[model samples]
Target: MEYYFITGTSKGIGKALTEAILQNDNTYVYGISRNCAVKHARYHHLHFDLSDTTALRNNLHKVFVPLKEAERIVLVNNAGVLGKIDYIGSQATDNFEFVFDVNVIGPAILMNTFLSAYYSQQCPKIILNISSGAGKRPMDGWSAYCASKAALDMLSLTCQKEQELLGTGVKVYSLAPGVVDTAMQAHIREAESDQFSELERFKLLKENKELLDPEAVGKKILQLLKQPQQYSSVLMRVDEI
Candidate 1:
């Protein structure tokens, strides 16, 4: 049986992926998020606020389990935040803290925990971090978000090298799922043009119905998993995959 652990499963790509993976009778999903939005016999939801590391660490037993008959184990870090969508100086310091806590620190802890829990397991293991293009390029008002994601990309690359040295065969990647129509996008749309220079561009994307759908993106991710080696870059875009 295949096992998948996903964060941010209450909505967006996380929720879509969980539901898509559950269509198979031989797969089980452990979803971690603030709320439980999925209901299925094989889908288990663990309520978590990613910023609360102490609580998550204490309750991690519910997330990972021994893999006796598992075909593969996958961890998808999909939860993230945009923080305050304003220029660097205009945003509160706490906003940066919150963004890093959720985007970098939380995922780092989870990846460490996952490796520890399944270090000796022979099943194929994969770590997919939901990254953003903003991480690769500077954006006008996404300082916190971009920095956090850039950190996450480096983390994933480092882990991949570590896994290689250990001969663990764990596949680690940070992927940019370009422009998806999610709650985050809606929040971005609400930002004033003065604060976010891309305000008009984003508005046009929404108006033109150009944003990728969560479900379609989820399916594309599953397809990518089937042949991860084809797109060998540690940091990749969905189109390249």
Candidate 2:
């Protein structure tokens, strides 16, 4: 049997991924979220604010410590925050800190804690960080979101290198799920019109109807996890799939 750990499973891509993975009889999914409404015999739901690194680390250890040896263990760091968008000089310092805490620091601390307890002799482990195109390309009012994702991408790369050095059978990846229809989109679209240039771009895309389904993205993630050699250390975009 294969076991998967995922965060932000209350909604959006995270919820979709958890449901899709649970469809397979051989898979067990452990989901972390602030709230989880889905119930399944194979699903283990954990509730916590991921922005708290120490608490997250402690919770992760408590959860994974009891799992039996398995052939594959997958960790998806999917929880993230897109703080209120504002012009670079106008944005509050607290906004940047909050974004970084959720998107970058939270995942990094989780990975470190998971690795410290994981004995890879039982299975090939993998870490998937759900990044964004905002990390690669700049948008005027998305400074905090972009910067956090960029740091996450680099952190994934650094983790890949570190895993190779340690000779651990663990692979890390940064994946972009494209523009999916989610609550996050609503937040982006609602940002101050003058400060957010991407608003028009997104509006245009929506008008032209260019939004991907979250379930489709989730399915692709499952496929990638099953074929780790094909995706290891790569920044995969849903559009490319």
Candidate 3:
């Protein structure tokens, strides 16, 4: 059986990804999130707040379970928050901590747990961090978010290097899933023009129906995983897949 532990399974791309992975009867999914939105025989939901790093670390045993004959294991760090949508100085300093806690620190802990849990398991291991294009570029009001994702990208790359040195057979990737039509996008569109310089552009993208569908993006990610060898870069974009 193939086991996949995914974060943020309550909504958006995470929920879509979980549903897509469940299409196969031989696969089992452990979803980590505050709430559950899917009901399936192979799906196991674990309720936890990603921001609470201490609780998450203590309860990771529920996510990484032993399998009789596991074919593969995967970790998808999909949960993220779009911190305060204002210029750096205009937003509260605490917002940076909140954003980093959810986006970078949470995933880092989970990745560590996954690696340690399956240290001796003789199966293919993959870690996919759901990053954003914002990480690769600077935006007016997205300083915290962009910085967090950039940190995530570097973390994934550094982890991949370590795994290679240790011969751990782990493939780590930090991928940007483009602009999906998720609640996050709605939040971006609603940002005030004074805070976010590109507010009108984001609104136009939504009005023009240019945003990628969450379901489609989720399926594409799964397809990309099928042939991981074709891509060598640790940092990637969904469109490239």
Candidate 4:
């Protein structure tokens, strides 16, 4: 059976991906998020707060059995935050730390714990971190978000290299989903122009109806997961697929 462990499954691309995975035969999903938005026999909702590392570690027991038993296992670190939108000088220090806690530290902890728990498994194990193009290109007011994704990408790269040297046969990738129509986008569009120089660009994306749907991006992610052999790069862009 194909098993998916996804974070931020309450909404957006994570939720869409969870639902999409469940549509396949013999597929099961373990959704970790604050909200339990979906109810299905194959979908198990594990209430989790990405900001809390202790809680996440404690809850590892709840996911171990499925991870060990599944024929194919996939972990999608999809939870993230944009933090406060403003120049670095004007940004709140607390918000900066909070963003790293959720977007970088949380996923890193999860990855470490997951590897410790199921590194010996013979199944096709995949780790897909939902990264962003912001990680690659410097943004005007997205300092925290950009840094967090860049860290995640580096984490994936390092893990991938480690697995390669160890012959673990696991596929690790930090995938950029491009511009999607989600609450995060809404938050971006609402940012003040003075704080976010590209506020109008984001607003124009919404006004021009140019944002990609979360569901479509979710499907593309699934397609890539199924054929990971074809993907040679650990840093992937959905538009390139």
Candidate 5:
């Protein structure tokens, strides 16, 4: 049986993805969220804050210690923070630092920890990072968000290279899920009117129903995991799949 370790499963795309994956009869999902109360026969929910990186790392080690003995591992680093909207110069340093901690450093550390345990097992493994289009193209007021995603993209690419160097079967990719209807979008829409750009653009997009469904993205993720050979070394966008 294949096993998936996913984060941010409390809501939005993460929640949808977790449910979709658990539908498979041979699948087991370890979902990490700050507020995970949902119970299922095949799902294991663990509550922890991503802000505490060391604690998260330790907890993940504990979770995988037994699983590593039996099955293959797939790590999905999906939890991320979209910091307050502000221009580059006007943004607070704390916002940038916090974003990096959640988006970049946390995932990198998790990959390192998981790989250290999985290396000896020689199991087929993959790390999927939930990145954003902001990483590919800059947005005027999304300084922290854009930078954090950019860092995450690089981290995934670098990890893939390192895996190749070690001659390990593990593969990694950073994926952009596009604009989805999530609380994160609500936060962006409610940002200070003056600081946010193209409010009309967002409104028009919303009115035109341009947002992708979270479940659709979740299914695509499951497809990727099932047939990973199709996406081994590149950063994939949801639109492309």
Candidate 6:
């Protein structure tokens, strides 16, 4: 049997991935999100929000209960938020905290618990941190989003190093799903040109029908989980898959 623990399952790529996993036999999914929109015998939905890190920490022990029956375990930290778009000093200070809370703190908390909870499970373990190109290249008015994702990439690298140092067979990747047609893009396209200088680029991407589908990205992610050893421990970018 194989197991998948995913966040942000209420919508977007997380929801698509969870549904895809349910189609497989002898597979189980432990999904964390604000709402449980999926129903299946093998799918277990855990209620939580990434923006609320306190609740996650308080209930860390409650997760990963079905790991013992699994031959392989995969954790995908997919939940994230794009904070209000504005110039660095023009945006509210709370924007940074809100964005970092979901994009960074929540994933870190979940990664810690998963590593510690299933440390002894002799199985193929992998952690996929859904990152973005914005994390690698700077974009004006995306300060909070870019910073949080950049930190996520660094954090994933650090975790990969620590796992290797300790001889844990866990592989980690900070993957960038380039320009997916998600609600986040809608939010970006709605931003005023004053703050997001290159708002037209995103608008044109939409007008030109260039946004990638979430379902397609979900399939590639599933393939990665199935054959993780074929890729590098710290490799990234779904386009390369």
lDDT of 5 at 148: 85
| lDDT at 210, model 5 | 88
By TM-score, the better pick of 2 and 6 is: 6
Cα lDDT of model 1 by residue, 57-176, tens digit: 888887887768889899999999998898978888899899999999999999999999998888889999999999999988899999999999999999999999988889999999
**RMSD each, Å:** 1.0, 1.5, 0.9, 1.2, 1.7, 1.1
Whole-model lDDT, candidate 4?
Answer: 0.89
Output the number of the lDDT-best candidate: 3
Tens-digit lDDT track of model 2 for 25-128: 99998888889867999988888887776787666666665567676888899988889788878878788888898999888887887787675456889999
lDDT per residue for candidate 5 within 14-133, as digits (tens), equals: 888888988988788888878885468888888877778778766776656557444568999999888878877887778877888888887888788878866787668989999999
Candidate 6 lDDT at 29 equals 90
How accurate locally is residue 176 in candidate 3, as Cα lDDT from 0 to 100?
99
Better of 2 and 3 by lDDT: 3
Model 5 collision count: 0
Candidates, ranked, lDDT:
3, 1, 6, 4, 2, 5
Model 2 accuracy (lDDT, Cα): 0.84
- Can you write out model 4's per-residue Cα lDDT over 1-241, one digit (the tens) per residue? 8888899999999989888889988898889898999899999899988888788777778865635467888889998999899999998788888899899988988788778778777889999999999999899889999999999999999999998998999999999999999999998988889888888888888899999999999999999988999998999999877
In the range 38-146, model 3's lDDT, one tens digit per residue, is 9999999999998888898888888788877889899999999997899977789899998999999999999998999898999888999999999999999999999
Encode model 6's per-residue lDDT on 1-241: one tens digit a residue: 8898999998888988888878899788999998888899998889987888898898887787746667889899999899999998788999999999999999999899899989989888999999999999999999999999999999999999999999988999999988888888999999999999889999999999999989998888888888887888574898878
Looking at model 1, residue 37 earns an lDDT score of 89
Q: Against the hidden reference, what TM-scores do the models get?
A: 0.97, 0.94, 0.98, 0.97, 0.93, 0.97
- Model 4 lDDT-worst window of ten: 61-70
For all candidates, what are the clash counts?
Answer: 0, 0, 0, 0, 0, 0
Error of 3 at 11 (Å): 0.8
lDDT of each: 0.91, 0.84, 0.92, 0.89, 0.82, 0.90
